[model samples]
Target chain A: MEIEKPYLLFLGDAPDALAAKTAQGIVDWRRDWCVGQLRLPGCLADTGLPDLDIATARARGGKTLIVGVANAGGVLPPHWAAPIVAAIAAGMDVAAGLHMKLADNPEIAAAAAKHGRRLFDVRHSTERFATGKGVKRPGKRLLTVGTDCSVGKKYTALALERAMTARGYHADFRATGQTGVFISGRGVSVDAVVADFISGAAEWLTPANDPDHWDVVEGQGSLFHPSFAGVTLGLLHGAQPDAFVVCHEPTRTRMRGVEHRLPTIREVIDLTVQCGRLTNPDIRCVGIAVNTERLSDEEARRVIAETVRAEGLPATDPVRFGVEAIVDKIAEEFGLP
Target chain B: MEIEKPYLLFLGDAPDALAAKTAQGIVDWRRDWCVGQLRLPGCLADTGLPDLDIATARARGGKTLIVGVANAGGVLPPHWAAPIVAAIAAGMDVAAGLHMKLADNPEIAAAAAKHGRRLFDVRHSTERFATGKGVKRPGKRLLTVGTDCSVGKKYTALALERAMTARGYHADFRATGQTGVFISGRGVSVDAVVADFISGAAEWLTPANDPDHWDVVEGQGSLFHPSFAGVTLGLLHGAQPDAFVVCHEPTRTRMRGVEHRLPTIREVIDLTVQCGRLTNPDIRCVGIAVNTERLSDEEARRVIAETVRAEGLPATDPVRFGVEAIVDKIAEEFGLP
Candidate 1:
């Protein structure tokens, strides 16, 4: 079967010069190959795209894909997802460099499924590839920590990263969400798809020096934050990090009330593992990070560790507990040691 | 205008038997005084009532009000705000027992305008009333401390309350939003509406006392938290707290990106004051409560005091400066001394 060219769709405030340059680059790069590339030029309509140009693009090749580069800031609007999905179903690889997740839009997900094209969230992808180091082999074991927005996941991850570096391990902090550069430090740059590719490439990367100098990539947000979640899932699928670290905090009242009913950490962890399995089936048992405020450090660690362990998984204290100890436990559990 | 029965809207899951019984008691008591009180039957949508058998009941005409009582566990869909506003505008004085605030839903402000009724979030109305008793005296001064959720607002308020009580004046902790029940052995509740009514009733209830009792209310969540912000605003409007103790950390990163965008403490203070004016026009300058997390006691106090005074307002360290110092400064400002 002669593969059709990739279809790219651009959304958001009018494309900037950089985006145009990137698009032209991709088109030119594909010109030398047998791959055909086309761009869809129109805003998504309320009833979905009914334009004839889109149809022509689909007819030219069964590989109709929509690539959208939007700077709308947050998540892609649900309405925009429908047209992209339609374009994808017409046989195209749909790629969006939206700083947000499109998975939040069911229509987009459904459309992606119909088109057999994966929905790649660009935020995590951009973060993974921020330093443009591309994918490199790990010199040691790598672990990534992630959480939902406002959940104190980054602080926990940073604390872990600091802990690992203190142990004389060559550690690097890789941020995977809408996290700007200053927060995550300079590291490799990989888009969502590319991060997954790099994760697969990790198997062939450089061998670990101390077997612990591996990297610690921080997942940006929860499985619910549009872009962050998808990238986390993709990385988990591709890289199969030694262990997943979950950070969570109880809502204010501590008492789960009617409207403010809080989801238990166990439920959240279970859901996380389940979601990760969709992308990668080899996720090991989860570890939990509890933001300690109001509770004393000792008490917070003990309580969270006990709760997580009771949920039938190994849990470690992200605060008082050293990262080396945590990694060791995870290594033992995953047979990495 | 012929007066009509008043109603109360209860939003929540099925009210507990105790709550339902308490509600019925209020209705029965009001009935004896010819104040016809009715509860929204079953769900909120059941707006129709069995033809008011008014022939058998004596007329107690004041206003026709709608009261809704809902279980705390029920999900009050966002759309419910529209009907709630409509019920309030249709000359129905809607009084809800559960906590409701504009901060909880930014859309509430717009929806309230659509129905020509302003949203009066009373999440802490009950708690405010319970604590106002301690400060209920003619010419008695009241003060409040607030912050976004989890910023140590409760501790600041409690500490201030203790400081006032230790000074031979009646001082109590008033609940504004997230705070509830026995703190430092004082009965604290987070009810703003009830506090306002209690404040009004206290003046008439106790004429012999100096009315120098101070009520300290604690606010929850950041300025953006939907429930806490509205509760803070409502309490300020109703109680007209004599002064505000702004609890904050000394670190620059504490402001997140707000410091760069909003830029100076004066701008932040002015923005707070402007928002407060939406609920009350009489708020005086605010003081500062520095969280002593990473700072030494003296350093924290000095920085907080300097920051507060820099805004041209009185500032005191809750840890080093003591509540007495704060009260003394505020009293002097109000010419109480």
Candidate 2:
């Protein structure tokens, strides 16, 4: 039975009046889209008051679950069984909650396990807007790059983005994984939660919704990134980008008396290629984007060029190569342009 | 000052003959002693390996540098100038080649880069042996558990290890990071060339120094595994351990995501805790260990009760209570136990 409207509940620590107002905003927004009425449960009626019955939600079913722990200006206390139980009782297949502290509690964990619910921990609400399966374009072009955490992925991605835009192709940047914003040309943590949400939501949206936008999604962190790896791989598999751009530095050193070996840049590229082939054989490797930190530009260029050529690939200016060049190459290779 | 040992050159795949011979029972075992000699040029060797460059070594001021591609393999062609030039003109540095594939068409990369040097990628002949740090007796005791890879960290650490262990004394299971075998295991890999030499000269002694031992040594994966995170932190920071045992799971799922995430587990734990403390200051935590797929009665009991809890901690079972129990009752209540 197709229920036209899904009910959403907002539980938080905000003052009753303000919290109710914010809850009203959510309800209004959803109502515009013909989603069923959004309501604040009376269990959270008091402003600046703690409700222990949040667990009671579990008894209720078929309702959208949304709980804002920040309304209390802190994490949920250990006694949050009531409201949590309620949510579980409600037959929530998926339950998302704000506040990292929830992960540390055993009772909530047990409740989640008992209910067989997946918890989406949202650190930034903005990112949530973009989470979901994006519309597919069979022959669409895309690129991806990664490195160890704090290894200059954003800088390299942004530089590549600017280069591509300068080359005069329609391009837009989508953060495929975790990313930080640059303020005054310096990286600053904006809102990882929001960014993640947006990325996720964008997945469900079609490129046709916004034509003329060629997307270059940035992946955060190295191969082992908890969320990044799964999300990036999923996007690549689903979106089926025509080509890939790998950013790497070959001069890093390993630790002493330790043997946790990382696959080389070449190895990573090869694995990506293998995965790409398995997913979509038509996708081709365009080139590599190498960050020249210790090496001078001339040295970096020469070494990168040699390495690329050795791998049987055409090398381009890593600093100057952008989205347009990638699109052009993909078009030329695939007979699109 | 040239030594009579005629600087042995171990080239080709599996070049560390001495290490191989040692592992194969060719050499007598010694603790905390180097098994081979590495001679660095007053300046770095020219065109022999990518990591042995004289200029780079000089730049680091004669300290041993652990530089190499994380999983470099195969041969190099003559044309590859950057790495080759860096290797040959060396000062005092150890360069070990593993799975390097630059031997074919090496000249093309070098000539293209306009660097002139006779390059030969040679493997190192040294074998590193494990030396236990010796038993530590801290003011307070902490038990650590770890697996080779993923292997049910949260379950084993909190459920099994902490539950049976936390009694009588003040104890807790706090996650520090993901730990692996290579970073904490014993043994080393011997170069193939060294193995050949030992085979010809010390055939009688080869059984003890097998290459398999070397591979095992280098195979340890993490120092800060999630299962082992609590224990590793205690070990490094002088938290005494009454006893410690690693949980071994034979399944591949336990070891699957380890390669990429193990190295970063330490950082993640630290960040999570610090982030948590910023909002709330009541979290208490202690040591941790691994959860094995199968455990002998003796091993299981020892891990669950004696080894973990013998120190007379406050809690009876930590695994049941989860991280909150450790944080509130242990971390915030005590200093370091």
Candidate 3:
């Protein structure tokens, strides 16, 4: 689903900053794409954009109202309907990352229909995708894989996109999750698609491009995470990445939300190459992205150094350190100038 | 979705038996659950059941009309709608494995609503499932893993279920595909569910049971298959089978609908165990099931014997021979008497 640009992020009655993490993510990465923030009275969360009403945001060239907050049950609160309908009435499209669709609200649906405005439900895929063909497609691709869920896969990819583009390489960040979709403005929420179409959706998201161009594709759940490894494998196959960066959280003892222990980075690389060879024969690990937020500066450096020595690849905390080293490794490995 | 018993198989103007293979599968597996066949004019397919009109089938105590034939383009022909409506009017729920939902047809929806009848769209899941938790549940489970798609996974599981039951062990065949669902009378079409819930749906299908009772789960796709490995992986994590059988087709040249070549039986066993260990660390291969339809009787026996020697597991053609050897292996391995 392709959402319009210059969004007015709707932070509806969010109780804390964590509740509006999606909005915060957009603000963190693509602050220029956001026109303003629209929050209800009880909302305690903030994206720190200029607060504006629907009319003001629309006048400022906001083409979409992004409902980027998570309600307690992922539901659309009854009171938030008015502002969403008002945005639609004002000729702006609406997009949401909620479990519930925006069009499910009667007021929002009617307003969109009357105004000929679109409602993008990013969590629900409206695209009908054919099954993945697994045929080799043109273009270079790099995917970010994780040791576990929420282990900086998206951040690593987005950072790579920025770094590679700055270094005169043609690159685009391809998204596979809701926040990533809103940031990229066009992507399929791969997990939300039917089980049969996981890889198919990923294939569609990263179609054949120029031979030298790179699709820095965002990844999802770890291959060892039982809850979501299917999504991770499908994305891995569909992306057919020539190079991948393994994202890891060193402090985590167990996989997120499960009893299974996190797999070692070596294990992740071995299995990824084994399975990824189906679509791309030359799939290889290029670097490591460590999420060392919980570690001190000395510990982070020690971990990164140890990872580099052990894996024999560039390693860095994408948030704490820039992705320039990894970009340099990609250039050297792929013979890019 | 749980379909009612005594189905009236609807073969709507199918030009050949291949088009009505699903109906034929139900007939072959569960003849007692079906009342009779309902064929439209010009139908060339037959399950060798008594021909019956809608009224006659309903009179014979058919509770559901199974639209078990695939029409051209997976669309319901306009001509067949009248009979479907008539069947609903006669107090029978309708279940179909078509790509298009039954309720999408206005006439069928109206008829079902008017008669308080239900519509079962097997290709479209209406069941909400949580993400798989990967927690071990109590039961003895055996899953069929395939070297490729359409390699007799379902048949192997069903055969094992029958054999184990006749040997005085409590066993149930858990369906994961369309035809298996019809034959078993209940199961979520795991591939049709949202990608995030593939394992979750499988867990629900084979829930906690008696320690010795076996849930013989039907498998889909293969770990080596490019288009469907995600579903296969999710099923592996979710089913957490204590023992598995590798199903192979002896004469296949490549993986189904893809350019990649098939993996060896050893590769399938190794990978299924490697990935399946996330949920069930005790996962092991008990046997091998080969589809020997294209082979001569002597060739089939030779291939089976070779497979037994190579893999050190019980091997047989479930269709040509029987699953008795596999059942014996399972009984011995699990101390099931």
Identify the runs in model 3 with alpha carbons over 4 angstroms from their true place: none
Error of 1 at B161 (Å): 14
> Compared with the true structure, what per-residue lDDT tens digits does model 2 show for residues A142-241?
5564533344444444554555566665555544321221101111121232212222333432244233345555544333222123223334443445
> Which of the predicted structures, 1 or 3, would earn the higher DockQ when compared with the native?
3
Indicate the worst ten consecutive residues by lDDT in candidate 3 chain B. B328-337
Cα lDDT, all candidates:
0.43, 0.35, 0.93
Candidate 2: Cα lDDT at B246 = 37
lDDT over C-alpha atoms for residue B22 of model 1 = 26
lDDT digits (tens) for residues B247-294 of candidate 3 = 999899989999889999999999999999999999999999999999
DockQ of 3: 0.85
Cα lDDT tens digits, model 1, A48-106, are 22224446766654353434344445456555565676666666655444545665567
For all predicted structures, in order, the TM-scores are 0.31, 0.30, 0.98
User: Of 2 and 3, which scores higher on TM-score?
Assistant: 3
Best by TM-score: 3
Q: Top model by lDDT, which number?
A: 3
DockQ of 1: 0.01
User: Candidate 2 on B1-337: residue-level lDDT in tens?
Assistant: 0111111222222234432221121112111121222223232222132332345334534322122222132334233334333443442222323335233344433442453322222232233212111122222322233334334443433343333344333333332221111111111221121111211111111112221111011111123332222112212222122222233342234333322223222332343232222112222224333242365655544544543454233222232324333433343444222
Error of 3 at A332 (Å): 1.9
